[model samples]
Target: MVIVCCSILIISCIAVVSSGMKVSLEVDRPWLRVHLSQRAALECCYRTGAASLRTTWFVHNQPANGTAVPVPVRASDQVSSGYRMRGGVTCGTLTFAEVKVADSGLYRCWFNDAGVFTPGTYLQVYEPLKKTINLSEKTKDNILMAEGFLLLLCVLVPSATLLCKSKQLHALEQKKATREEENIYQGLDLNDCDKAMSLYQDLVANEQEEIQLENP
Candidate 1:
């Protein structure tokens, strides 16, 4: 007799629950990260079972607890925000447009059939700070880049100039050595030695002038 009574109670409870049973509200994009001063979309989805679905927007979990209201689902393609106007969930989706820093919080999507309740999902909005510098920062970056290139060029140009001079000096040395070998039978000549010394002095003076210009 007790078992029969318990069975009846169980059947009554199941009937009450299944009568209001609805599809699960699974929010596709829950955790959304956004940068400061940039626009983002908080997307949501509700799983509509065999029966057609109804959707309402909410914030901070509970619906009635705050100012969050239901966007009437409309039948047309005209999207009021991202969801249709008539609470008519198409493919069970919704979009929170132009999301801001203050919008950084939890959002809710409730699934319903007529006026009855089902289930929902929570969306976490994250606002990450981003720095977009003004004219001053741009100017500083440019100046730094220019100075670095200028220094590199200055160093490289002088090294190249010195390398060229050394090569020329080596050539001159070879020529003088050849002449000395030839003149071994003829005797000593002071003119060639004087010309080489003059060239050396000119190179030294030019290099010193360049160094002074660069440093200043």
Candidate 2:
């Protein structure tokens, strides 16, 4: 009869422990963005009525249908993984020595105590801070591009102007040379007076011969 009475008491205690209880989950930060090779701490705080609890950490991905995959947290020379328990509360800290690109995802903390499980706190981990060109960098790039264009214009415009001026100068020199050659030819003709008189005598002789042939 004593054994039966003890079993009944145990059953009643189990029933009371398994009853609905209020619990809440809290995180230190709502979102986090970290760089590669940097350490990240995902702090989780759970408030529950249970005196003792067992907590599990998981990484959930949407492609996996929000399934909670358990993360192996062991105290190692590289990474330290552990949890702390206080009066009616627990905090689990997962630390990484060096973060990688594959480590970016959503994390959650699950707890179970006395058959009651509380919803977890989600911790987001990022792979690394992306190298982004901010407004100033973009503006600097634009300025550099504009400067390059202006420099090219400065070089090309002067080269084009010099080329045009050289063409114009060459034309003027050619015209001047032609005019000087014509003046030299005129001076030579004016100096050859004997040759002009001989040509006029030959023309008069041919005209007299034509006139005598016509009269005969």
Candidate 3:
């Protein structure tokens, strides 16, 4: 029973080591974007030194929904419809001479002998004209927003300044008026009681003379 358990443990260790020894593939770019009719390339490399290993390239097109379906890519030595395979042995490169919008997809390099596929690179193709138009529209929007901000500053700054000046002028006018009133009060001689009585008696005498002249 002990021997059987030891054998099982040895088998488990062998399996773990085998799994760890599996070849790992690396891709140069995970995502690539190019304009229509532009050249594009994807490079894949692996550490395994054996040149006899078969490598394959596959493309998965973006779908409306659900899982993407991968299609095998086959190319010959001579450029077959602009698709060509380059590099050798430990590395492989898939290239497109002139990429079309339809060529936009996820690409993966598979090591057939190792039964492993590298993490895919997604290719995106776009129209330059459309991108330029969208950029122009965004620029126009930014310009308009900036102009509106400047206009608001132009209006608000002057209005605030004029309001402040008007308040200052009103305060100054009130102060001037108050000072004039104070000067008028200071000019009065309220302490001259005898002079005031004499003026009142003269006013009464004038009134009596006027009444006599009118009756005559």
Candidate 4:
């Protein structure tokens, strides 16, 4: 009877082991960093199985083997470990109360019953970037401004050239007209007898009219 009871117990244990569920870790955020008004928090959740699941936290700081720290599915006062349960999912959070430069590394949450792991989350702790200029965007703006100026120049240059050419043509026409008038005056011949006689008669008539006005 003792042998039969032992067999039954063994069979029950086996059945329980076989009924254990496979689990997967769910990460809330993959990237963590130190920022103003924001604390560093890493959360991973997994569904509960028929049996209590074993969870482990691994931190890969160096190229060698990582440090494995077992995590209980219970809350702790320690700054490195914490747990919470919601909607049938158990979530484990690792909090860095005081983020350090050395905290920048890869972290992983592993589930043993489900034989699955959460992808590594890279945590970065550093000084926040200050307000500064974006040179790339500024450069693009400057290039566009320069292109606009060049386009304006391209339009104005041809217009100025055409204006100058018109002025030159107008000046040439004026000079040609003056030259033609001078040539016509030079071509007149006062030595012609009829022209000389006509000029003498006009002079005599002008002198007689001035004398008559003076006497009257």
lDDT of each: 0.54, 0.63, 0.70, 0.66
- TM-scores, in order shown? 0.36, 0.42, 0.49, 0.44
Model 2 per-residue lDDT at 57: 57
Q: Give the better candidate number (1 or 2) by lDDT.
A: 2
Q: Which one wins by TM-score: 2 or 4?
A: 4
State the lDDT at 109 in candidate 2. Answer: 50
Stretches off by above 4 angstroms in model 4 are 1-24, 33-38, 50-54, 62-78, 111-116, 129-216
Question: How far in Å is the alpha carbon of 75 misplaced in model 3?
Answer: 4.8
Error of 2 at 14 (Å): 17
Q: On a 0 to 100 scale, what is the lDDT of residue 6 in model 4?
A: 48
Whole-model lDDT for model 4 versus the true structure?
0.66
lDDT of 3 by residue, 32-121 (tens): 998888888776665544444466888888788966798987675421322223364256678888788888888876555655566667
Best by TM-score: 3
Instruction: Per model, state how many residue pairs clash.
Output: 9, 0, 0, 2
lDDT of 4 by residue, 92-190 (tens): 777766666756676666555555456556688777778696578889899999999999999999999999999999999999999999999898887
Q: TM-score ranking from best to worst? A: 3, 4, 2, 1
Q: State the lDDT of candidate 1 residue by residue for 64-117, as single tens digits.
A: 566555334333332233443235444445444444455544444444443322
Backbone clash tally (model 2): 0
Mark the 10 consecutive residues where model 2 has the least summed lDDT.
114-123
